[model samples]
Target: MKYKSFAVAIWGVVILLVILVPLPTVLMDILFILNITISLLVLLNAIYAKDALSMSSFPTLLLFTTLYRLALNVAATRLIIGQGDAGKVVESFGEFVGGNNIVVGAIIFLVIMLVQFLVITKGAERVSEVAARFTLDAMPGKQMAVDADLNAGLINEAQAKERRKNIQREADFYGAMDGASKFVKNDAIFGFITVILNIIGGFIMGMMQNSGASWNDILEKYTKLTIGNGLAVQIPALLISVATGIIVTRAASDEELSEEIISQLFTGPKTMFVAAGACFLLTFIIGRFFMIIVAAFLVFLGIRMQDSEQEKIKQDEKEMEERTVEEIRKPENVVTLLHVDPIELEFGYGLIPLADVNQGGDLLDRVVMIRRQLALELGMIVPVIRLRDNIQLNPNQYVIKIKGVEVAEGELLLDHFLAMNPGTAEEEIEGIPTTEPAFGLPALWITESQRDRAEMLGYTVVDPPSVISTHMTEVIKRHAHELLSRQDVQTLLDNVKSSYPAIVEELVPKQLSLGEVQKVLCNLLREGVSIRDMVTILETLADYAPVTRDTDMLTEYVRQALGRAITKTFITPDNSDVITLDPQVEQLILDSVQKTEAGSYIALEPSVSNKIMQNLLKLVEKVAQLGKQPIVLASPVVRLYFKRLTEQTIPGLVVLSYNELDPSVKVRSIGMVTCS
Candidate 1:
């Protein structure tokens, strides 16, 4: 650390000297000696420490030092002389000015340019690190809380954890890559411009001398040049630094750095110096004191910008907090049932637990009672229902078998049924209503075959018509309640409905056509819907005479109905499941795949799937020719196919499923663990 700091300090002093002095032969010799000494020390320290010497600070220091050396040379020759022999020196000076000024100026400009380039490049690296740190810090325990909730069965653990990890890893990788790429490109482009500026400055200086201006006159004229011109060279450097700072800071909030702003900062300095005479006139009266005032104003601007940025950050944080609070407080009309083992239920899938069934029963009872009240007003019959003793899974799907009927099919519907009570808009079913009047109702039907199967399982079926009537009423009431309660929810529903009418009203007989309604309905279906209510609504729409005959009208109506059903089922469940996977998992998988391709069969440490192992082997086969090697498959719950393959002793297929692999393999695996 001490050595590194020393190297940086030496570099800084060199830059300071160059900025304050000019490059004479003596000064150049002195600079060469200084550079050699510092370079040797840096190399020695790097060798001793067994680390790469930081290349980041070198260019900036070198450039500034060159500038100071050049300045000193220019000032000495221009500003000092005796009266009589001064003319002889002046002629010598003119020769030097004509021939050497451009070269010296170019050298100084090149150095400063290089320094700026290095600063941008290295600064980006530092910025990326800061960005990653800030992003990690900004989470404020949210990820941990999400993990805890998942573990506690408040959410789906596997899916949520996977998603969370994915999100974090993606964010980290993108942030680092973006920062690095952007900075490198900007640095290169700016460095090129600096080279051009140096060439221009050299040309201008040579021109002044060729016009017979004395060194003293040139110096006096320089002093008279505008403060803006004096600042022009340094302004690009300052602006670039400020931009780098902003880019680094913005990454904390996950916002992107603007390329336009960076470009403006780089180009602004050169453009400012286009009219040197005008700048000189302004500088003569205002002098350096005015430059000082501008500097002070810039400092003030920096302070104000910092304060504004900080306040904006605070406001955003406050809003996020409020949103989080609102989400937590938002009434959950649905209660999720988890750890469902579809295999146990004898359904093709899995079974939800007995405890979840009991909770479902209680919720069902409340919904039924609400439906009964609503049905009385609608002149519909209310079903008298009793919760059955035995729970059976629907053979066709992992649906809950109540009495003889499948309460819900599909993972999506089952999830909704478990989480939401009937009569809540939050749990509306999705997707089935567009093509058929039965919509999602078929999913809830208790077929005669299903009833007989349920009876064998020690359950009895309730009357179908009564159950359907009661269910429909409950669903409607729930939807109405939700629409009345939530502003955002209501707005979304209204938005979908409003689009068709507005389209018709504005473009009737002109651009508005039946196609517009179809488009609107398609959009709504894609969004999501309540399958249960959608089926009922579609049936009701069929009964309405006006919608029954015209295919276009029916198409639009069906589409909207399907959308409503889909909305109820998909939207509610999605909101509740917000877990994301760690990025390392994907990176690890990708790296492992890459290595295996390079003639090495690699075993992945225990993780999410058997697929990762398969991918590793595939990658190895693609990259190199290897004889059949025992590719160990290490993960929890070894697949039956893998076990069978291992037992057969098949060539190119040796599967060892265990947590502890051999030491040699373990070392190899470390190389496969990727970092972005």
Candidate 2:
């Protein structure tokens, strides 16, 4: 590697030396021949490159080749004008082409210069400029697309990184090529001026040295050498310019230019047969014997191409069948719900504009932020969500699915704004009426024109994407406990095992299994508690798991340990109302609560259960009138049993134990639950 790098460094020094110091004729010929070889290699690489990034270094290499050619031009001018002897290459060209006429040599040089400067170089420069501008302009959208794929779990972290790198490389390559094009344009102008100057200086020198030399002799000797030098430089420069044009204009593709031309252009046999018929007709009129040969070859090639295409298709089908047979033999694929994402957000075709990053929608980015927020607030990692479009639904509808089951669906006018009454609005805002899915709030789907007025009317305004995102957040929160599997518990343990290894070592498997831990965590999350403090919960479990293996019991113990945090969360700072069970009602429940091997259960008569539920509903309504949260403070013995009893019949009742309330919190008794 060092030797190769040193050799490249040495090559660059030689180009500089060629300009500052005079070189031997033999060395000049070698460098001149090497330049032509390098140009051809670059042109061939461009023709065969599968895409522009395959030849990402072409722009830098172009600059070096252009510089080397310019150095050689300067060196050759010095040799011809100073000593009237450039090299054998210049001498042979002069004698062969313009042995008697200088006009022919000059015209040939003019033609090559014009073709390079006016055509190839000019076109390549324009292409490079346009490619650079467009690539840069599309960069933000491309980056957002990669990010969206990452959030949607279509690709993993490593794949997303590779994709992002390719995007950046494409932008960089085009920008570099834009600047590199200037080298070719300048090289063309420099080559023309160098050739003309060398010819004029040589003529002046030859006339001065040989005073009796005729004008024809001086002009003939000088014009031929100048034309030879110009051809040596311009021919390779033209090839480099063609390569640049090819590199800049080439679109990304999976196949090389040769394969693409054959696969796409010649894939159909009809065009080939039509061309063959045309060629056969041409042979009847003009004696183009080659036309008949061409016609025959086209007919043969058409048959061969069709046969090859059929073979490829048959091979592909055979491979697909083999794969299907293999898949059938394996039972995993048949029953593998493991590959299905835990959560998925599918939107309709018209709602697609809300998720597309190119259309200024960042729903995917918002999903990422929501995941991070859930992890912090809920203390469990939400699984990566898969996003897709569904055409079977309404165009403006979106469905939220949990484990492939649609749990929630909502519709949005993507062009309109959602204006929610902050519950304090005195009058209704004029627009389409819609219910906010997340909280079931009364909201209006207002147009852009009504957005400003709605806000002015004391309404909280949100965009369509925010509406969908809000709905997704609430649905996920509602189903969080069901989403917590044994796998998730193991993951949680593994995450914290690194920091508190001893706590995890003693608490899990030794005391409680992962399933027990998952159940306990689910119990806490069922009531919307943040388990971010996993260490404390694990410690509490470690202390109590020996006596009782019941998850509900373990969860109650964990809650008491987290009393201060819990009290701070739901209770207001003003130390307001604390709704407690009446002593007579509490005693009735505590006396009925029965303890057995499989946890505890509270059994009561139908009349007693009915009276207790009626009194509880009245107390709940009284708390609502006072603008305070309804929390039933009771003894620890029946709190767990009461939790299960009220779960089905009473939806919004929060049952808390006396030990779960912090002493720092002050409270006044709002009312009592009784059977009066």
Q: What are the lDDT scores of the predictions, listed in order?
A: 0.38, 0.87
Clashes of each: 68, 0
Top TM-score prediction, candidate number: 2
> Tens digits of per-residue lDDT for model 1 on 1-676?
7598587577667666664554444544454344345434533332232111122333243344334433433333332221111122223333433344444543454465566556654665576576566657755476877778888988897877775775576455535544444544443464364334433443356455546866554443332221112123333333434333343433222212344445445343223333333445556677755654555555555566566768989999999999988777767622333223211112332222221446442334444665466444322222333332233444223333233444433322222121111222332332222111112323233344444444444432343223333444434432332222233333333443464454333332243334432333332222222222323433434344243343333433443344433223322322221111124644444344422223322254545335444454444453233222223333422322233323323233322323223222321221121122
For each candidate, give its TM-score against the true structure.
0.21, 0.54
Off by over 4 Å in 2: 1-333, 336-340, 625-628
Model 1 lDDT, residue 405, Cα: 41
What's model 1's TM-score? Answer: 0.21
Q: For candidate 2, lDDT tens digit of each residue in 459-565?
A: 99999888888888888888898888888889889989989999999987889888889999999988878888999999999999998898888999999999988
Give me the candidate number with maximum lDDT: 2
The CA lDDT at 191 in model 1 is 39
Error of 2 at 642 (Å): 2.0
